[model samples]
Target: MRRRLPAVLALPVAASVLALAAGPAAAQVETTPVPAPGNPGAPPASAPASPQPLGHAVGDAGTGLAVIRVLPNSTPTKAILPGAADKLPKQAAVELGFGLASAQANSEAYLAYEKSIAQASPGGIAVQGSSPQAPGSLAQTAPPNNEAPLTGGINPPSTPLDTLVKVGALNGSVSANWSDALGPCVDTISDASTSIASISALNAIPTLPGGKDLTGAFDAPNLDEAADNAVVEQLKNLAGPLSTLGGILGGQGSAGGGSVLSLPNTLSARSVVKLVDIPGSPNKAVQSTSTLQVAALKLLAGTPFEISINVVSQPTLQVTSTGDAATSAVQYTAPVLEVTQGGKSLGRLDAANPKLDIPISLPLPGADDLPGLGDLGKLPIVGNLLGDGSPLRDALSKDLQKLDLGVLRLAVAGLNQTGAAATQPFKGYQLGATARMVDLQVLPTEALGLPNLPSALAQVSLGEQVARAYAPEGGVVCGTASAPQAPPAPAPQGSATPQLAYTNAAYHSVPLFWTGTAMLLFGVVLVAALPTRRRKTTD
Candidate 1:
């Protein structure tokens, strides 16, 4: 009983692993909940003829910020097991990188501008000043320049009176108009900067574990990834142009214009991180098994952690957009999800009613070489005696089981999915992120005495509509394969059947053990009874 204590104690660890695994898996979650602010009350239309201009570009503009989170576990987890998971490790791949950025509407007043870009291009602007550009004939009639030879102290012909008025009128008009417009333009720039900073601060915020304190400029998101994912589809369509622009502007996009147009620009955002120590809990009942250890640092999504993250994005109202006012809309499309193998789309995820399943794979350590089993086996009497019931095997199994490699790997996978980014409003300085979905599964080839494969995902909603999600054939979104596939049911003609997943649970063979016990008992009874007397015994 004493010898088996370790295994008995470790049994809970295994159960906890299963329980944790079976625990509901959370979906791709937004780390930052955009802070809800009482609007900084919209600036008055036009300040009473002041030197400074009014609200930025009064042609109708708005600002927004989305706060996503950084997965601090990304780097360390990757180091532990490389290529086993993807936190969307790379992007800026297509048009999809920039959008699916949901306009989370809080009040009815702000809903209208949720999807609208802050810088208004045009849909009939309201300008109160004269045209800064002079008209072709009367506006720009500069008298012809006459080159005349100059004598030592003599000058050429007297200036024409008509030319003087024309020049004076044009100059006066231009100077006055520009002066008035200058203030507003500067105000607009200031507004844009404030918006950028606010968004950046919101997206890359840090917090205590389990999101405690929540101290930041942003809020904890009640947002969904599906909705956000849906928004991304529109973005992917523009990948062609973005990729093209990158080429024209020179591929080094991380440094201002050098990489402004580049595709797949990586963004890392680490700052104000400190060495944290974590105490390990061996089990719920028996919590601290190890001493305090250094903890992993956290990073917020969309902030710059590396110099390479420098991207070129600038906001402007220089060019007015021309569009039909009749074409105004309040509708926006979201991204879709799909599963593909060899570039062939197998099926699509329902955007309206989205469901995502991620497989959490953990590489299990094999029983290849036992440290002392070989030496013990070589011993004379002990080797033969300890054949199948080796204590060493039992101890090793307990130790190996206690390590919980799978669970650790699962944590890493979750971290890899830590951060995600939206294309800044104007593709500004903070352009893209290296974040991606943590899809690589590290599965152990063999079972580690688990009762049933635990469900690896929490049932958290990723508060956004999605266009398409790429997944494996069986939509095991967040757990290891627990069972085998069952035979397909017959379906009606031409209709695609829903892809269903099935897993087999490990169970004890109660009936088989009972039946064997009964047989042995019967044989013992017969031997004791001695139905007939033996030949040597007198009958």
Candidate 2:
């Protein structure tokens, strides 16, 4: 029961981890959630203008941090035999495959450029195992350059950008993005922000004891983030007579009036543990224990010893001001551990009930005597010779005392226990952590009084992932004088000079209709008097 305290205490630790992993903060330092996107308040447009510029950019454009953690070979296995120094496999070949990085982009105009190359590098251990095997189970040959420069402004990736690598017993990708986390202050109207990270380990040797030889036995832990964006627009006011005349001339208002656009980003993230598929529990973490089977000795005859766990961590940030946010709280789900024996259940342990103690009786029946000694005390002649007064009967009985055959003990911590990072923007420093997801121990065959049992069937420890993420803090400044302003509104039509219609030669112009009538009459008279015999001959 005393061994269960760690399981009971995993709740609070898990809670903090979830809080750290919850998406980007909604607001940053000195910043409030802007009215949903383009909806600036009516007061900002009509209210008296402040002598000061809209907002000034302040502080450094904070740094970006990322990491992938795997325990070292020196770490002891979950289960240790009485005198054996079993250690994890050496991981000399595992190189930092673009999983670690630190980068910065200045929000100020003079320093407006970006810097990703100088900081990006391969970092942190990438695999967890405790076998004496040399060179470890994972290895990478000719790792590619881990750095990739950014285009489209100094914006960190708003979407996940990843570098992939694959080698013996290792395959996966690492990614991160902080698009607009530090917006350009060159203009006050363009605000955008988001910071997130993700990691996917698709294939690696299982961290569980006796898990190496089991075909298809592996662990995959993944982290992912999703972001929501809102766009905002700021427009300059159009007033005064000149502005009205421009409207009349079909021209946009004064030469420099227009709207500024901004996108404020929000995010949500989830940490996922994808391992063996557990029965009746979809998406939960699981490990297969097939390598510990000893069919000849009837030890763990249960062909498939499956251990399942439930753990999830989500971290959330609450923005306090522009370009600044901090982890506020976390959502925690109690962790649970369940074990299945040869198709049958041994028992389970969870936050609510943190105790799991079960005993397995020896498979051999009618074997009351020690394996090396016969039932000498029970023989009629021997019993008489080694009477109650003698030490032979008493000693023999004590040596044959029954021993528990095998037992299972398990402890599971929330995903938070796996790893965490703490940020100190003021100090420009970050701290990292590494922890275990699960701890499991099963009685070895030697514990069953079988000293000559093969080491394969003597697993002592089984556990899962450890991880971390980190970045130095930064500040943001909004540009004032150099910031671009909105363009003028277009001029309205139909205001041309009205006098042009009234200024015509004032009624002095001839009435063409009367003149045409007089001409027609004259022509008729001439034709009647001088040309009377025009068509008579033809008739």
Candidate 3:
């Protein structure tokens, strides 16, 4: 009986062992960050500012952005802000920062002036992580803080950063106010700024019943419990007859080991939030955008139950204001949900609804269908045990629980407040962009001929983002009540035409009129006298 145990129990032992090894290991988030797209810290490309006189330019704009990506079982790497001009200097367990009225000099004059008054004061903060729990990869920051040095041409920009942990999330972000007073009179001011952030695997899958965080993801313990609940005992009773069949199959009866879900090869979220205070004009404009792309969800590693899924989402907003009249436009998009069963497709689900319910069925082998157990049904005790309605089949059905396919959720929203001095009565309008994707309750399980197997072996999520951006009212402006005007140039010497000198004389029209009247009177008298003589002779 002892020698027969190993061979008889091989199938159950192997299945249970495979379930135990299906869980994913704790690993650092890996990322391949790319350069941010579109105009960073500037207005949208679709809309360009209209032409205006040089010194009359005036505008206020801002944006905020962030990014986080988690990759397991790979080398720890740094996450970069897509459009930032600089990179992180070094790796630290933990980094924290804070700042105040820090600004960069963007104009030639301001840059030169900054050199004269600029003293390196402690305007920013930095702290490194040293503790074991601190992975030295975590980072955090507040307003005015920067992950890298300023480009030295704008108001000190605010750039904050954070790291990904077990929950699989991190953030990279930047924002700033840039204003330059240039030209000889320093009357010209140009301003522009923006902000954004990105995240990965937004959150964790919820823990479910049966002490299984992920359904069939790591089922070693669950399988053991099921075995203890009479599964192994029932299998042993029938193993003696099926041993030959199990051997003929060459140990291929159990579902292959490993996770059920694949990692996101292309999970990413990007946002373009930028503002511009029109130079030489009271008009201001801003645009906000949020985009998310998730690679197909590939399931059922090393099995026929493998499948795939693709998700999509996007939101946008644009606004322009004349400081008294505001105008705006908005756009949004929804996604489609598709499910696949093994090599076959299950078609699409109702996208408007979030709940999902799908059933699975597989063909089972009959008593005579067993390769080595063809005549087993003809035996006495064994025939009864192997016949229809047997306890072994019941035990297998009772132990193989339903698979939890998990949920994928996406959300997006946009906000644009136009600046209107009359009704809105705000110096600066607020612009916001937000997008997020969440995956929860993922436990991939599928029924085989007997017990259950993981439906897929892949990573749960690709990446995530929480879009939050803003553009404040005022920036660097002159202290004067009204804008100063440029002085006129002096007249040149030795010009082509000489100027006429002023003369002290009576009004020309009055003098000429009186002289002409006196002459007329004298001439009339002489003509009358001479004409009288002539008229008398003619009469």
For each candidate in turn, the TM-score is 0.18, 0.28, 0.34
Give the runs in model 1 whose Cα sits over 4 Å from its true position. 1-68, 71-329, 337-350, 363-539
For residue 313, model 1's alpha carbon misses the true position, in angstroms, by 23
Preferred candidate (lDDT higher): 1 or 2? 2
Runs off by more than 4 Å, candidate 3: 1-177, 182-260, 276-282, 300-303, 311-330, 347-351, 357-433, 443-463, 469-539
lDDT of 3 by residue, 1-539 (tens): 01011222223212211111112111100111223546788653332133211221122111112112122122222445663423433322222211111111121121222210111111122122121111111111111122332212112232332111111222222222222222111211111122112122212211211121122333334445553333233323332212111111112222132123443343333333333455664533333334444545543323323345554333222233222223333333434456555334455533355434332221122334444333422211210122222323343344422222222222122122322232121243332222223222232332111233222211232222222222224322222233445568988878578676647555477889999999999999988888343444553
Model 1 lDDT tens row, 237-292: 22121211111111121111221111122111100000111124111110000000
* Best-fitting candidate, scored by TM-score: 3
Q: Can you write out model 2's per-residue Cα lDDT over 9-122, one digit (the tens) per residue?
A: 223222222222222221112111224335555343232232222222221111112222223232343436663535433322221221212212112222112211012112
Candidate 3 or 1, higher lDDT: 3
Instruction: Order the candidates by lDDT, highest first.
Output: 3, 2, 1
Model 2: how far residue 38 lies from native, Å: 53
Off by over 4 Å in 2: 1-174, 178-327, 340-345, 355-402, 414-436, 443-539
Q: What is the lDDT of residue 456 in candidate 1?
A: 23
Q: What total of clashing residue pairs does each candidate reach?
A: 66, 50, 58
